[model samples]
Target chain A: DVKVTQSSRYLVKRTGEKVFLECVQDMDHENMFWYRQDPGLGLRLIYFSYDVKMKEKGDIPEGYSVSREKKERFSLILESASTNQTSMYLCATPGAGGSYGYTFGSGTRLTVV
Target chain B: SQQGEEDPQALSIQEGENATMNCSYKTSINNLQWYRQNSGRGLVHLILIRSNEREKHSGRLRVTLDTSKKSSSLLITASRAADTASYFCAPESGSQGNLIFGKGTKLSVKP
Candidate 1:
Protein backbone atom coordinates (compact mmCIF):
# COMPACT_ATOMS: atom_id res chain seq x y z
CA ASP A 1 0.00 0.00 0.00
CA VAL A 2 1.15 3.56 -0.72
CA LYS A 3 1.74 5.75 2.29
CA VAL A 4 1.76 9.51 2.76
CA THR A 5 2.94 10.79 6.11
CA GLN A 6 2.69 14.18 7.77
CA SER A 7 5.15 15.32 10.36
CA SER A 8 2.51 16.33 12.85
CA ARG A 9 -1.15 15.48 13.41
CA TYR A 10 -1.89 18.46 15.65
CA LEU A 11 -0.08 21.71 16.22
CA VAL A 12 -0.57 24.98 18.09
CA LYS A 13 1.28 28.15 17.28
CA ARG A 14 1.09 31.75 18.42
CA THR A 15 -0.08 34.41 16.05
CA GLY A 16 2.74 35.93 13.99
CA GLU A 17 4.95 32.90 14.53
CA LYS A 18 6.44 31.00 11.62
CA VAL A 19 5.00 27.56 11.04
CA PHE A 20 6.19 24.60 9.01
CA LEU A 21 4.20 21.50 8.01
CA GLU A 22 5.96 18.54 6.50
CA CYS A 23 4.69 15.75 4.27
CA VAL A 24 6.44 12.69 2.91
CA GLN A 25 5.26 10.04 0.48
CA ASP A 26 6.78 6.61 0.18
CA MET A 27 5.56 6.17 -3.40
CA ASP A 28 8.14 8.58 -4.83
CA HIS A 29 5.47 10.23 -6.90
CA GLU A 30 6.30 13.15 -9.18
CA ASN A 31 3.46 15.34 -7.97
CA MET A 32 2.82 16.67 -4.46
CA PHE A 33 0.20 19.12 -3.25
CA TRP A 34 -0.72 21.27 -0.25
CA TYR A 35 -4.26 22.14 0.74
CA ARG A 36 -6.11 23.67 3.65
CA GLN A 37 -9.49 22.16 4.59
CA ASP A 38 -12.08 24.17 6.44
CA PRO A 39 -15.52 23.24 7.69
CA GLY A 40 -17.59 24.75 4.91
CA LEU A 41 -14.90 25.34 2.29
CA GLY A 42 -13.69 21.78 1.92
CA LEU A 43 -10.17 21.58 0.54
CA ARG A 44 -8.50 24.45 -1.29
CA LEU A 45 -5.19 23.96 -2.93
CA ILE A 46 -2.44 26.24 -1.66
CA TYR A 47 0.52 25.05 -3.76
CA PHE A 48 1.78 22.06 -5.70
CA SER A 49 5.06 20.75 -7.05
CA TYR A 50 5.46 18.40 -9.99
CA ASP A 51 9.15 18.02 -9.41
CA VAL A 52 11.91 19.05 -7.08
CA LYS A 53 12.41 22.84 -6.99
CA MET A 54 9.40 23.35 -9.26
CA LYS A 55 6.28 24.73 -7.65
CA GLU A 56 3.04 26.32 -8.79
CA LYS A 57 0.48 28.39 -6.93
CA GLY A 58 -3.04 27.06 -6.58
CA ASP A 59 -6.41 28.64 -5.90
CA ILE A 60 -5.59 29.84 -2.37
CA PRO A 61 -1.89 30.66 -2.16
CA GLU A 62 -1.96 34.05 -0.57
CA GLY A 63 -0.92 33.17 2.96
CA TYR A 64 1.09 29.99 2.38
CA SER A 65 4.26 28.81 0.63
CA VAL A 66 5.62 25.36 -0.16
CA SER A 67 8.97 23.61 -0.61
CA ARG A 68 9.75 20.40 -2.49
CA GLU A 69 13.45 19.78 -2.12
CA LYS A 70 13.11 16.04 -2.66
CA LYS A 71 10.85 13.87 -4.74
CA GLU A 72 9.29 12.17 -1.72
CA ARG A 73 8.92 15.21 0.52
CA PHE A 74 6.92 18.44 0.38
CA SER A 75 6.61 21.12 3.02
CA LEU A 76 4.12 23.92 3.63
CA ILE A 77 5.18 27.12 5.37
CA LEU A 78 3.31 29.92 7.02
CA GLU A 79 5.54 32.98 7.10
CA SER A 80 3.46 34.50 9.88
CA ALA A 81 0.62 32.50 11.31
CA SER A 82 -2.69 34.20 11.91
CA THR A 83 -5.95 33.22 13.58
CA ASN A 84 -7.58 32.78 10.20
CA GLN A 85 -4.89 30.33 9.19
CA THR A 86 -6.01 27.83 11.78
CA SER A 87 -7.39 24.87 9.84
CA MET A 88 -6.71 21.32 8.74
CA TYR A 89 -3.75 21.06 6.38
CA LEU A 90 -3.53 18.13 3.99
CA CYS A 91 -0.76 16.90 1.72
CA ALA A 92 -1.23 14.58 -1.23
CA THR A 93 0.82 12.81 -3.89
CA PRO A 94 -0.40 11.85 -7.31
CA GLY A 95 0.77 8.92 -9.35
CA ALA A 96 2.84 9.41 -12.54
CA GLY A 97 0.14 9.81 -15.13
CA GLY A 98 -3.14 11.57 -14.60
CA SER A 99 -4.86 8.18 -14.71
CA TYR A 100 -4.41 7.36 -11.02
CA GLY A 101 -5.95 8.99 -7.97
CA TYR A 102 -4.10 10.88 -5.24
CA THR A 103 -2.85 9.50 -1.93
CA PHE A 104 -3.22 11.87 1.00
CA GLY A 105 -1.54 12.21 4.35
CA SER A 106 -3.32 11.94 7.69
CA GLY A 107 -3.48 15.78 7.86
CA THR A 108 -2.37 18.31 10.45
CA ARG A 109 -4.87 20.29 12.48
CA LEU A 110 -3.28 23.64 13.29
CA THR A 111 -4.55 26.16 15.77
CA VAL A 112 -3.29 29.72 15.70
CA VAL A 113 -3.95 31.44 19.02
CA SER B 1 -15.28 30.38 -4.77
CA GLN B 2 -15.54 26.61 -5.20
CA GLN B 3 -15.46 25.23 -8.73
CA GLY B 4 -17.87 22.50 -7.74
CA GLU B 5 -20.75 22.37 -5.29
CA GLU B 6 -22.35 19.35 -3.63
CA ASP B 7 -26.04 19.22 -3.00
CA PRO B 8 -27.82 18.19 0.23
CA GLN B 9 -24.93 19.16 2.49
CA ALA B 10 -25.95 16.38 4.87
CA LEU B 11 -27.82 13.09 4.68
CA SER B 12 -28.93 10.54 7.24
CA ILE B 13 -29.75 6.95 6.35
CA GLN B 14 -30.15 3.56 7.97
CA GLU B 15 -27.75 0.71 7.42
CA GLY B 16 -28.51 -1.52 4.41
CA GLU B 17 -30.02 1.50 2.67
CA ASN B 18 -28.69 3.46 -0.30
CA ALA B 19 -27.27 6.98 -0.16
CA THR B 20 -26.76 9.28 -3.10
CA MET B 21 -24.74 12.47 -3.24
CA ASN B 22 -24.62 14.87 -6.16
CA CYS B 23 -21.90 17.23 -7.33
CA SER B 24 -22.02 19.99 -9.91
CA TYR B 25 -19.06 21.75 -11.46
CA LYS B 26 -18.73 25.08 -13.27
CA THR B 27 -16.27 24.29 -16.08
CA SER B 28 -15.08 21.60 -18.45
CA ILE B 29 -13.04 18.88 -16.84
CA ASN B 30 -10.66 16.17 -17.89
CA ASN B 31 -11.85 13.85 -15.16
CA LEU B 32 -13.94 13.82 -11.98
CA GLN B 33 -12.92 11.95 -8.87
CA TRP B 34 -14.78 11.07 -5.68
CA TYR B 35 -13.21 10.70 -2.25
CA ARG B 36 -14.26 9.80 1.27
CA GLN B 37 -12.91 11.27 4.50
CA ASN B 38 -13.43 9.97 7.99
CA SER B 39 -13.52 12.31 10.93
CA GLY B 40 -10.24 14.09 11.67
CA ARG B 41 -8.41 12.19 8.91
CA GLY B 42 -7.28 12.53 5.33
CA LEU B 43 -9.35 11.62 2.30
CA VAL B 44 -9.36 8.27 0.56
CA HIS B 45 -9.88 8.00 -3.17
CA LEU B 46 -13.16 6.33 -4.10
CA ILE B 47 -13.37 6.40 -7.87
CA LEU B 48 -12.66 8.44 -10.99
CA ILE B 49 -14.61 8.78 -14.19
CA ARG B 50 -13.34 10.54 -17.26
CA SER B 51 -15.37 13.10 -19.17
CA ASN B 52 -15.70 10.65 -22.04
CA GLU B 53 -17.17 7.97 -19.79
CA ARG B 54 -20.60 8.12 -18.23
CA GLU B 55 -20.44 5.64 -15.37
CA LYS B 56 -17.94 3.79 -13.24
CA HIS B 57 -18.22 1.45 -10.30
CA SER B 58 -15.99 0.04 -7.58
CA GLY B 59 -17.13 -2.34 -4.92
CA ARG B 60 -20.47 -1.04 -3.63
CA LEU B 61 -19.72 2.51 -4.83
CA ARG B 62 -21.21 3.66 -8.11
CA VAL B 63 -20.30 6.96 -9.79
CA THR B 64 -21.97 8.55 -12.76
CA LEU B 65 -20.81 11.56 -14.73
CA ASP B 66 -22.78 13.85 -17.05
CA THR B 67 -20.45 16.11 -18.99
CA SER B 68 -23.28 17.87 -20.79
CA LYS B 69 -24.74 18.92 -17.48
CA LYS B 70 -21.43 19.23 -15.65
CA SER B 71 -22.70 17.10 -12.83
CA SER B 72 -21.91 13.79 -11.15
CA SER B 73 -23.55 11.49 -8.65
CA LEU B 74 -22.17 8.99 -6.19
CA LEU B 75 -24.31 6.19 -4.87
CA ILE B 76 -23.35 3.87 -2.10
CA THR B 77 -25.55 0.79 -1.93
CA ALA B 78 -26.34 -1.20 1.22
CA SER B 79 -24.22 1.13 3.29
CA ARG B 80 -22.93 0.10 6.68
CA ALA B 81 -22.26 2.13 9.78
CA ALA B 82 -18.59 2.17 8.86
CA ASP B 83 -19.55 4.00 5.65
CA THR B 84 -20.41 7.14 7.57
CA ALA B 85 -18.10 9.90 6.40
CA SER B 86 -17.80 12.99 4.25
CA TYR B 87 -17.80 12.60 0.48
CA PHE B 88 -16.21 15.10 -1.90
CA CYS B 89 -15.95 15.39 -5.65
CA ALA B 90 -12.92 16.95 -7.35
CA PRO B 91 -12.61 17.97 -10.96
CA GLU B 92 -9.27 17.90 -12.74
CA SER B 93 -8.97 20.53 -15.43
CA GLY B 94 -6.58 20.76 -18.37
CA SER B 95 -2.95 19.79 -17.83
CA GLN B 96 -2.37 21.72 -14.64
CA GLY B 97 -2.77 18.52 -12.60
CA ASN B 98 -4.57 20.42 -9.89
CA LEU B 99 -7.97 19.28 -8.62
CA ILE B 100 -10.75 21.69 -7.75
CA PHE B 101 -12.89 20.23 -4.97
CA GLY B 102 -16.51 20.62 -3.92
CA LYS B 103 -17.79 21.46 -0.47
CA GLY B 104 -18.62 17.77 0.20
CA THR B 105 -21.64 15.84 1.49
CA LYS B 106 -21.68 14.47 4.99
CA LEU B 107 -23.46 11.12 5.31
CA SER B 108 -24.53 9.58 8.57
CA VAL B 109 -25.33 5.87 8.63
CA LYS B 110 -27.55 4.75 11.48
CA PRO B 111 -27.36 1.14 12.53
Candidate 2:
Protein backbone atom coordinates (compact mmCIF):
# COMPACT_ATOMS: atom_id res chain seq x y z
CA ASP A 1 0.00 0.00 0.00
CA VAL A 2 1.10 3.54 -0.65
CA LYS A 3 2.22 5.29 2.51
CA VAL A 4 2.58 9.00 3.24
CA THR A 5 4.08 9.81 6.60
CA GLN A 6 3.93 13.11 8.42
CA SER A 7 6.60 13.77 10.99
CA SER A 8 4.34 15.35 13.58
CA ARG A 9 0.72 14.72 14.45
CA TYR A 10 0.38 17.85 16.55
CA LEU A 11 2.54 20.84 17.31
CA VAL A 12 2.41 24.09 19.25
CA LYS A 13 4.64 27.08 18.67
CA ARG A 14 4.90 30.58 19.99
CA THR A 15 4.10 33.53 17.83
CA GLY A 16 7.00 34.70 15.61
CA GLU A 17 8.66 31.29 15.90
CA LYS A 18 9.80 29.36 12.88
CA VAL A 19 8.12 26.01 12.21
CA PHE A 20 8.71 23.05 10.00
CA LEU A 21 6.32 20.33 8.85
CA GLU A 22 7.70 17.27 7.13
CA CYS A 23 6.16 14.71 4.83
CA VAL A 24 7.59 11.65 3.13
CA GLN A 25 5.93 9.31 0.69
CA ASP A 26 7.17 5.90 -0.39
CA MET A 27 5.27 5.75 -3.69
CA ASP A 28 7.96 7.66 -5.60
CA HIS A 29 5.34 10.11 -6.75
CA GLU A 30 6.39 13.06 -8.87
CA ASN A 31 4.11 15.62 -7.31
CA MET A 32 3.93 16.86 -3.71
CA PHE A 33 1.78 19.55 -2.16
CA TRP A 34 1.21 21.46 1.08
CA TYR A 35 -2.17 22.83 2.08
CA ARG A 36 -3.67 24.47 5.13
CA GLN A 37 -7.20 23.58 6.10
CA ASP A 38 -9.51 25.82 8.09
CA PRO A 39 -13.09 25.65 9.36
CA GLY A 40 -15.06 27.27 6.53
CA LEU A 41 -12.37 27.86 3.92
CA GLY A 42 -11.42 24.25 3.29
CA LEU A 43 -7.98 23.20 2.10
CA ARG A 44 -5.96 26.06 0.61
CA LEU A 45 -2.89 25.15 -1.30
CA ILE A 46 0.23 26.77 0.09
CA TYR A 47 2.91 25.28 -2.13
CA PHE A 48 3.48 22.45 -4.54
CA SER A 49 6.54 20.79 -5.99
CA TYR A 50 6.48 18.87 -9.22
CA ASP A 51 9.99 17.56 -8.88
CA VAL A 52 12.91 17.60 -6.56
CA LYS A 53 14.31 21.11 -6.03
CA MET A 54 11.43 22.67 -7.96
CA LYS A 55 8.58 24.43 -6.24
CA GLU A 56 5.61 26.57 -7.20
CA LYS A 57 3.48 28.92 -5.20
CA GLY A 58 -0.15 28.06 -4.70
CA ASP A 59 -3.09 30.29 -3.86
CA ILE A 60 -2.23 30.73 -0.20
CA PRO A 61 1.56 30.73 -0.40
CA GLU A 62 1.89 34.09 1.24
CA GLY A 63 2.63 32.68 4.67
CA TYR A 64 4.31 29.41 3.69
CA SER A 65 7.16 28.01 1.62
CA VAL A 66 8.09 24.50 0.52
CA SER A 67 11.23 22.53 -0.14
CA ARG A 68 11.62 19.24 -1.97
CA GLU A 69 15.17 18.09 -1.46
CA LYS A 70 14.38 14.52 -2.40
CA LYS A 71 11.68 12.90 -4.44
CA GLU A 72 10.24 11.11 -1.41
CA ARG A 73 10.35 14.03 0.96
CA PHE A 74 8.75 17.48 0.99
CA SER A 75 8.86 20.06 3.72
CA LEU A 76 6.67 23.04 4.57
CA ILE A 77 8.24 25.95 6.36
CA LEU A 78 6.56 28.76 8.19
CA GLU A 79 9.05 31.61 8.23
CA SER A 80 7.35 33.27 11.17
CA ALA A 81 4.39 31.65 12.78
CA SER A 82 1.43 33.75 13.79
CA THR A 83 -1.83 33.14 15.62
CA ASN A 84 -3.78 33.11 12.38
CA GLN A 85 -1.52 30.36 11.05
CA THR A 86 -2.97 27.89 13.52
CA SER A 87 -4.65 25.25 11.44
CA MET A 88 -4.43 21.67 10.23
CA TYR A 89 -1.69 21.28 7.65
CA LEU A 90 -1.95 18.51 5.11
CA CYS A 91 0.60 16.99 2.74
CA ALA A 92 -0.46 15.24 -0.42
CA THR A 93 0.96 13.53 -3.52
CA PRO A 94 -0.93 12.72 -6.65
CA GLY A 95 -0.33 10.52 -9.64
CA ALA A 96 1.15 12.20 -12.71
CA GLY A 97 -1.40 14.68 -14.04
CA GLY A 98 -3.46 13.76 -11.00
CA SER A 99 -5.16 11.06 -13.02
CA TYR A 100 -5.40 9.21 -9.74
CA GLY A 101 -6.54 11.04 -6.67
CA TYR A 102 -4.09 12.27 -4.07
CA THR A 103 -2.74 10.23 -1.17
CA PHE A 104 -2.51 12.43 1.89
CA GLY A 105 -0.43 11.99 4.99
CA SER A 106 -2.00 12.08 8.41
CA GLY A 107 -2.23 15.84 8.88
CA THR A 108 -0.19 17.95 11.26
CA ARG A 109 -2.35 20.20 13.41
CA LEU A 110 -0.36 23.30 14.29
CA THR A 111 -1.32 25.82 16.90
CA VAL A 112 0.48 29.12 17.19
CA VAL A 113 0.06 30.72 20.56
CA SER B 1 -9.69 31.40 -4.62
CA GLN B 2 -11.49 28.06 -4.18
CA GLN B 3 -12.11 26.11 -7.35
CA GLY B 4 -15.00 24.08 -6.03
CA GLU B 5 -17.83 24.53 -3.56
CA GLU B 6 -19.70 21.72 -1.84
CA ASP B 7 -23.36 22.07 -0.95
CA PRO B 8 -25.15 21.12 2.28
CA GLN B 9 -22.42 21.99 4.75
CA ALA B 10 -23.57 19.12 6.93
CA LEU B 11 -25.75 16.04 6.75
CA SER B 12 -26.99 13.58 9.35
CA ILE B 13 -28.36 10.20 8.46
CA GLN B 14 -29.05 6.80 9.95
CA GLU B 15 -27.34 3.58 9.02
CA GLY B 16 -28.66 2.02 5.82
CA GLU B 17 -29.80 5.40 4.53
CA ASN B 18 -28.10 7.08 1.61
CA ALA B 19 -26.03 10.21 1.84
CA THR B 20 -25.56 12.56 -1.05
CA MET B 21 -23.18 15.49 -1.47
CA ASN B 22 -22.81 17.97 -4.28
CA CYS B 23 -19.82 19.92 -5.65
CA SER B 24 -19.73 22.76 -8.11
CA TYR B 25 -16.67 24.21 -9.76
CA LYS B 26 -15.93 27.39 -11.68
CA THR B 27 -13.52 26.56 -14.53
CA SER B 28 -12.91 23.58 -16.76
CA ILE B 29 -11.29 20.54 -15.24
CA ASN B 30 -9.67 17.34 -16.33
CA ASN B 31 -11.35 15.27 -13.63
CA LEU B 32 -13.23 15.47 -10.37
CA GLN B 33 -12.61 13.34 -7.28
CA TRP B 34 -14.37 12.57 -4.02
CA TYR B 35 -12.57 11.98 -0.75
CA ARG B 36 -13.47 11.09 2.82
CA GLN B 37 -11.64 12.38 5.86
CA ASN B 38 -12.19 10.94 9.29
CA SER B 39 -11.90 13.26 12.23
CA GLY B 40 -8.36 14.62 12.59
CA ARG B 41 -7.04 12.49 9.73
CA GLY B 42 -5.96 13.00 6.16
CA LEU B 43 -8.25 12.49 3.22
CA VAL B 44 -8.83 9.11 1.57
CA HIS B 45 -9.75 8.91 -2.06
CA LEU B 46 -13.22 7.58 -2.68
CA ILE B 47 -13.86 7.96 -6.39
CA LEU B 48 -12.76 9.84 -9.52
CA ILE B 49 -14.80 10.80 -12.52
CA ARG B 50 -13.18 12.06 -15.69
CA SER B 51 -14.40 15.08 -17.58
CA ASN B 52 -15.90 13.07 -20.41
CA GLU B 53 -17.56 10.54 -18.19
CA ARG B 54 -20.99 11.20 -16.80
CA GLU B 55 -21.21 8.76 -13.93
CA LYS B 56 -19.20 6.02 -12.28
CA HIS B 57 -19.74 3.56 -9.46
CA SER B 58 -17.55 1.64 -7.09
CA GLY B 59 -18.95 -0.76 -4.55
CA ARG B 60 -21.44 1.22 -2.46
CA LEU B 61 -20.34 4.59 -3.75
CA ARG B 62 -21.49 6.39 -6.89
CA VAL B 63 -20.17 9.59 -8.49
CA THR B 64 -21.57 11.71 -11.26
CA LEU B 65 -20.08 14.56 -13.25
CA ASP B 66 -21.76 17.13 -15.43
CA THR B 67 -19.23 19.17 -17.35
CA SER B 68 -21.91 21.36 -18.86
CA LYS B 69 -22.92 22.39 -15.41
CA LYS B 70 -19.41 22.05 -13.97
CA SER B 71 -20.89 20.11 -11.11
CA SER B 72 -20.66 16.66 -9.55
CA SER B 73 -22.37 14.59 -6.92
CA LEU B 74 -21.31 11.79 -4.61
CA LEU B 75 -23.74 9.23 -3.22
CA ILE B 76 -22.91 6.70 -0.56
CA THR B 77 -25.47 3.91 -0.33
CA ALA B 78 -26.30 1.92 2.79
CA SER B 79 -24.40 4.25 5.05
CA ARG B 80 -22.72 2.95 8.20
CA ALA B 81 -21.41 4.57 11.30
CA ALA B 82 -17.93 4.25 9.93
CA ASP B 83 -19.02 6.38 7.01
CA THR B 84 -19.40 9.33 9.28
CA ALA B 85 -16.79 11.82 8.17
CA SER B 86 -16.20 14.97 6.16
CA TYR B 87 -16.53 14.38 2.45
CA PHE B 88 -14.76 16.67 0.01
CA CYS B 89 -14.66 17.02 -3.73
CA ALA B 90 -11.66 18.21 -5.69
CA PRO B 91 -11.14 19.14 -9.29
CA GLU B 92 -7.81 18.64 -10.94
CA SER B 93 -6.53 21.88 -12.39
CA GLY B 94 -5.47 21.18 -15.93
CA SER B 95 -1.79 20.26 -16.23
CA GLN B 96 -0.91 21.76 -12.87
CA GLY B 97 -0.21 18.50 -11.05
CA ASN B 98 -2.41 19.71 -8.21
CA LEU B 99 -6.00 19.51 -7.03
CA ILE B 100 -8.25 22.30 -5.76
CA PHE B 101 -10.46 21.10 -2.92
CA GLY B 102 -13.58 22.66 -1.61
CA LYS B 103 -15.04 23.04 1.85
CA GLY B 104 -16.41 19.61 2.62
CA THR B 105 -19.79 18.36 3.67
CA LYS B 106 -19.65 16.90 7.14
CA LEU B 107 -21.65 13.69 7.29
CA SER B 108 -22.75 12.02 10.50
CA VAL B 109 -24.15 8.53 10.21
CA LYS B 110 -25.86 7.37 13.35
CA PRO B 111 -25.82 3.68 14.07
- List DockQ for all candidates: 0.77, 0.78
Candidate 2 on A34-54: residue-level lDDT in tens? 989999899999999989999
Candidate 1 is graded, for docking, as: medium
**What CAPRI-style quality would you assign to candidate 2?**
medium
Give the poorly placed runs of model 1, Cα more than 4 Å off. none
Off-target runs (Cα >4 Å) in candidate 2 are A96-99
How much is the lDDT of residue B109 in candidate 1?
100
In order, what lDDT does every prediction score? 0.91, 0.90
User: If candidate 2 were superposed on the true structure by all CA atoms, what would the RMSD be?
Assistant: 1.6
- TM-scores across all candidates? 0.95, 0.95
lDDT per residue as tens, model 1, A1-113: 67999999999999999999999999878889999999988898899998999999988899888888899999999999999999999999875555568889999999999
Clashes of 2: 0
